[model samples]
Structure formats: C-alpha cells, structure tokens
Target: MTAPALIRGYEVVIGLETHAQLSTASKIFSGASTRFGAEPNTQACPVDLALPGTLPVINRGAVERAIRFGLAVGAKVAPLSIFARKNYFYPDLPKGYQISQYEIPVVQGGMVHFFVGDQAKTVHLTRAHLEEDAGKSMHEGLETPGCSGIDLNRAGTPLLEIVTEPDMRSAAEAVAYAKTLHGLVVWLGICDGNMQEGSFRCDANVSVRKPGAPYGTRREIKNLNSFRFLQMAIEAEVHWQIEQLEDGGKIQQATVLFDPNANGGRGATRMMRTKEDAHDYRYFPDPDLPPLVISPAWVDSVRAAMPELPGAMAERFVTADGLPEYDATMVTQSLAFARYYEAARDASQAPKLVANWLMGEVSKRLNAEDRDIADAPVAPATLAALIGRVQDGTVSNNAAKQVFDALWTGEGRDVDAIIEAKGLKQMNDTGALEKIVDEVIAANAKSVEEYKSGKDKAFNALVGQVMKASKGKANPAQAGELLKARLA
Candidate 1:
C-alpha cells in the first residue's frame, strides 16, 4: 500500500465492517421467510421469536453462501468453526443474544484490491463470519408518543459480517474498498447489495494520530447505509477528533451514530455507547448447536461452481481486448456491464472504441437517469453499430455524439438511419471540400496571413471556418488535410 498523505498533520486511519445479508430463502437458523417488506412480525417463526422449547437449526443455503464468499476473497474456509452466543440487551434482540462466530470464524483472511483514484490500494480482510441479523426498532409513526415499535421481520436474516483491517489511510480509500467489496458479493450472487433496503451496510471505524505516534482512540460509526453517508460521517468524525486533540482533550472509545440532519443538516456523529471489547459480549459456545464442520470436498464443490471473478475478467479484457486497466475495471464492474461491453466490442471489432464509448457516453447517461446498464435505451448491438460508423469515418466524432443522443433519447433506433436523417454524414467529396477550403481562405484573409506568419491557432481558425461553411458535414481530419494542401 502507498503511504497515505498526512491530513492536517495527522494520519487518518479507517477500517470497515460490512454486513452483507445472504440471499437465502429462509432465515439462518429458522424456516421463516426471508423476503423483505412483509408485514411486521409476520415473517418471524418459532426459532426467530425465541419461543419456549425451540431449538435452532442451521440453514444449508446460508452456509453455502458463506463458503462462496470465502473462496471469492481467497480466504480460508475453516474446516471446523463454532457458533457462540453474543449476550446483549436490546429490544430487537428476542433471544437476548446474537448467534455469531467469535473465536473461530468461517473465513479467516483475505484482501480486497481497488483503486483510490489512479493509485492502486489493497485492504486486507481479517475475517468474515456468519451471523443472524437482529430485528429493527422503528421509532417513526408510533401510535403512542415517545414510543418505538419492534419489527422482527429481519430478526433471523442470514448475514456475513466481513471485517477489514485498519489498512485504509483516508476516506476515499475506505469508500473505494467498500464499493469494490459490494460489487464482488453482488457479482458472486451471494448478496443482493442493496444498501437502501438494508441488505448491505457498513460500520466505519475512524481515528487520527500524530505522525509516527501511537494509534489514538478510535470510534466506530454504526450503520452507514450509503456511500455518501459513510464519507460524510468519516470526515466529520475526523475533524471532531482533531479538534478535540488540539483542544487538549482526550479521545474516548465509543460507538457513535451518524445523523445526517444534525447541526442544521451539516451532519454530525453522536455517542451511542462506549465501545465494547470481546469479553463485554460474554461469548460462549451454544450448547443447543454442535460445532460446524466442513470437509475438503465441500470447499472443492463450491470452488468448482464459482464463476469467473472480476479480477480475472479484468485481466482478460486487458490481455485479449487490449483495454487499459482502468477501463477494463470499470466495464467489468458488474456482470451485466461486462456482457454489454463484450457484445459491443465483438460486434464492432474495435475494442478501444467500444470501451471508450461504453465508459464515457453510456455510463454518463445511465448515471444521469439513475438506471443500470440492463436498462439502457440503446442496446449493445445498436451501440456497436454506432461505433462502426465512427470507425469507418461515416460520421465525425461530434456527429457521432449527436447520433448517440438520438438513439439514447429514443429519437431513432438505427444508427445509420439517425445519421442519414440528421444529415450528419462526413463530406468526402474532394472537389466540394476543396471549394469550401478556397472559400474559407478568401473569407478569412486575416487568419491566412497570420498562418503564413507562423501562428498555429490561425491555421486552426481557417479549418474551423471551412467546417462551418460545410455545415458541420466535413470530416475534420480530411478537411484539415485539404486546407493544408491548398495553402502549400
């Protein structure tokens, strides 16, 4: 990892704990439905509700997903792991404890590689453990004043809590890591990766210390559901910590909440509770459940079923398609996007052009409309056709953009049809182009004189005038060549 730049004479240290809700039909230890948006408490079964005489049964599907994740990150899938009871007191925790892996988690160690801008960085993973989610405490729209409602619908949802080491040095690196991990899990089909619906979320642990000094007290910001919030909360917390240290105050260890609307909507973090150590939870092996074991055959089967990972596909794009690393990474961000890129590249037989258009115009439009690649108005074949026109000089770069807009806005479907309808074809008629060049030279005598006096800008001005005279139909490179020949 590159050495992180000092921020205000302090080093900003960050780590993330991301909880990805596994895509299983039922809860981790119960038969209750795992579907979202069900009526409150309707999805809770006997084991989820912790009713009398109910024993937990592990879900095979959840275990399979965890194994998949371990393989994806190159983590160690422990042959033997144990489930422990994490004793805690919360209204949403029906069992008064969370069933989780403490001493021995399923996934041992791994690393996530991503780019913090142009600089490549890698964050090492400590572990990813299988756990059951707690219910939500809804404080809004309660019938009684100052009262909150408990919804157990999400109580038993299977979750894989992926913990990263303190490998990030800044907020940008942290967000990048989170995004890359999110894409990987979604690509693997293990998690839905929906932050808005709480299927995936992050807890950021942020701290600051003087250069070459001991690590300062850290605060864990809980439940940052969006990337924007994660960054904002970290920046806000870093500022607060620096200010406190400069004010001769000591930083305390605590778990805090990010209130985006706090301080008149500037966002701020407030104390939730003091940070807890491992002993605070009083972890102990669950007597009702025996030790979880996995054989070598189980790991081999999951490895065989796994699809090509993002890194491998990106490498292929670089080697086979000759795309740059950055472009390859962006196009392979999702499986759908990669498919679209491959289709367009193969159809156009122009790899670089296809990548440029996909990452440039296609991504811009999708982001503007808040749509995914699968929802793009212009199909991959249609984009490839447009790229082909550009390659064959059927349209200039600017004219091709106009055609792209037409296709994107549903003004036309066929690339050639749009080009023809808009009269955007390049002027390849040598005699006509020469005539326009002569007209531009006569009309812009001042620019012609300046060009003779060794001014490059004046020569470009003459070329522009010639293009204008042709009503933007002239191919820019060919027009320049014609003008230069006439001048010589």
Candidate 2:
C-alpha cells in the first residue's frame, strides 16, 4: 500500500503537435477573411468549402512565414514539399479531405529549449509544416432543443503544424514548452497566440512506457487551449492511462479530448484506428502554387527584424536590474509587463526601489483587479512620482499607501496635487514627536514596566502614540529610531 506512481515504473514520454493559426488578413486557400466570430459560413469561399472544380492556391505569405519560423528555430526549410489530402469525415470539415503537407514539410527538425522550474529541458522538433484549419462546431445548441451550429470562419485559415519529439517527462515540462512556443510565435509575429480564440491550439501525444520496453500506445488529446488546462489534461490523461494498464487493460492508440467540466477526466471519446503508416492522402506537388524557395538573404533579414524574445529579455532584466529570478520571471511573463517595469524604473528616482514597489504593491493591485499591465490605471511617471515622495520622506509609508489607493481608484487627480490637497506630509520633527513619545511612556506605565522587565510591549505602544499624535503622518522608520534613542 505505497503511494501509486502516475508514471509507475514506466517512463513518461510526451510529444506535442501544435497548430498555430498564422496572423494574416486572408485565408490560406481563399480570399475569404480570416477574422473570428463572423456569421456562420460568412468567411467561407468556394475553395474553402471544397466545391467541385475549386483549386487550392497556397498563400505566399503563409509559406514565407513557415520558413521564417524554421529559420528562427535553426531548422532547415525544405525547398520541395508536397501538399496532400488528409481524408476525414466530420461536420466541421467542409471538404472530405484537408490539404496539408505530409512526407515533405516546409520546415524539418528544430529544438525548443524551455524551463521546467529552474532547469531547462529541450523538446526536439520532428517537423513543422503548413496546413489549413477546419471550421468549428458548436455543441451547445445540439444538447438543447436546437440544431447544431457550424462556424466556417476558422476554416481555410493558415495553420502551422509544429510536431515535437517525445522529450517531455512531466506535465509541467509540457506546459513550459507550450508557453515558450507560444511566446516565440508571438514574438516572431507569425501568429497572434490567442489561445482563447483557438488561434494557437495544442494536441499532446502522451505515452507511458515501462523501463527498457517498447513505447506504449498513446491517446492524442486534441485542442487544449489554456496552459492550465494543458497541464491538467496531461496529468489526468497520463495517470488515467497508467491506471488502465495497471488494471490489466490495453492502452488504446486513438485521439482523446479534454473537458474541464468533466469529473476528474471523465470525458468521453470515440474510437479511431491510429495510423502508423504515412496516410495515403494522394500527396502531389502543388500545381497551383509554385515551389517556395527561400534564400539566405531573406532568412537573415527576417532574423534581423525579430524582436527581443521573452527568454532574452528575462536574462537581461536579472542582470541589468539586479532582480531575483522569480521577480524577473513575474515581470517578463508578458511583453507589456516588461515594458511597464522599464518605464516605471526609468521614471523613478530610485530604480530598485521602483522595482520593489512594482513587484509588491503594483502586482498586488493588478492581481486583485485581474487587470493586465497594459491596462494599468496609474501611469509610469505618476507612479514613480508617488514612490519618490515616500522615499524622500515627504510622505509616510502609511500615507503613501493611502495615496496609492487613491491613485489605483483614479481619485485625487494627480500625485503632487493629491498629496498637497490631502495634507499627507510626514512629520519627522523631533521636537513634536518626542513630546508625544514621552506622553505615551507616561500613559502606558504597566507596558513600560513590562519593557523595563525585558519585554517589547512598551515599544509598540510608544510608536502607536507617536503615529496617532502626528495624525498618522510620522515616518514609521524615523519614529522608531527616535523612540529608541529617547528610551536609551
């Protein structure tokens, strides 16, 4: 009766197949718009719908984009790749087959190095290819007394299918790799990285193998949108499959889908014959679209145009700002966040002081309101001014907190005006605060006796009396120092 291992004595192996919808105005094969959430089938065209005599023309922008991704990851962009039809029967698929690159993809072989906690793990890339996305189906109306609705807006959108080798060992590693990939795509401007809109989607290939044995059959979980869901689904699926095998059942090699609404991965799935052979989708060199030949000059130009990615930004933040790794990680989670900190720090008189306030006070406010850094109410210059007032002893920390509240709620106009109008100036006057301190010591005779008898009770009482006497304007640090001096 020991703790049952999720991977058991089996080695956990994971591969990810990600479909990132390219950021373009038009669809891959048609001139139909690629915008999300238009009227159902509004974005569809004759080619998107697979009508007879409709020929698929590859989008040149998408092809160039796929090669750009290959160059970014230090991969080889294949000069010759064949487009094939992936035959599948689903209401979502307008055509009987999906036009995708099979044997020869546009990009082949890359590696993604991502952090799992503090350690780095690399998910070796098997291939990345260009394809078109299918339409979306709404099951909500089907369960009710209504017809199932189909949205063809997503159909024919350019999709880059990035397939990774089985390198991940845990769910955390899987999520890390996904996040890194998402960031890279967004940084490259190749994809919008909008997971909620299904622009960036993931299908995880997870298998649990016994030590020194052939790989076990894996269930492919499809279309995981959120990072939290990605971890939850993988954890549940890996353990569920392991338990099934431990109970003397065979691991089914088919596709599965994740449902957060389900009770502990109690989701339903249909049986599919997993294919080991290259699917005979009748692949042929695209006649409509010529071969996509990329030159070294183009690759270098694109690389030069690439922005500073999250990994590089984080490293610089730690080195240049002298911040902790965790602090840097929190700040660089979004590009907006990194920019916000830099702006605030540059505006502040004390840079590290600004960082501390940002990491503590600003972050707390953002978390409570669930707001992003881009949407912050307080401007960088204004926030820096407020922090400066506290550091310069013009305002107490307590008063600064009040100012911060007013600032957060968009009250009191501006930082200087509000501080002046509210009379929140700190009292560091020794003559005034010392009298209050003496009065407190005389009033709290028993507490003072407790301190004289080697207790700390009297010290806080004196500090409280000083704060109250100054109308809560006394600088707490200066008050403590003066009170201790008087006592000595």
Clashing pairs in 1: none
Please give the CA lDDT of all the candidate structures.
0.92, 0.79
Q: For residue 329, what is the lDDT in candidate 2?
A: 65
Model 1 over residues 1-488: C-alpha lDDT tens digits? 46779878999999999999999999999999999999899999989999999999999999999999999888899999999999999999999999999999999999888887668788899999999999999999988989999999999899999999998898888898998988899999999888999999999999999888888899999999988899899989998999999999998999999999987877999999999999999999999888999999999999999999999999999999899998889888888889999998888898899889987999999978877788999998899999888888899999999999999999999999999999999988989998989999988999999998999999999989988899898988998998888888
Candidate No. with top TM-score:
1
lDDT of 2: 0.79
In the range 299-402, model 2's lDDT, one tens digit per residue, is: 67766876786667878988988877666765666677778888888888466776777778888998788666778888888888888888799998778888
TM-score, prediction 2: 0.78
Show model 2 residue runs off by greater than 4 Å.
1-13, 111-124, 138-150, 208-216, 245-248, 264-290, 315-330, 354-370, 394-406, 411-413, 416-427, 431-488
Per-candidate TM vs. native? Answer: 0.94, 0.78
After superposition, candidate 1 runs with Cα above 4 Å error: 263-265, 442-462
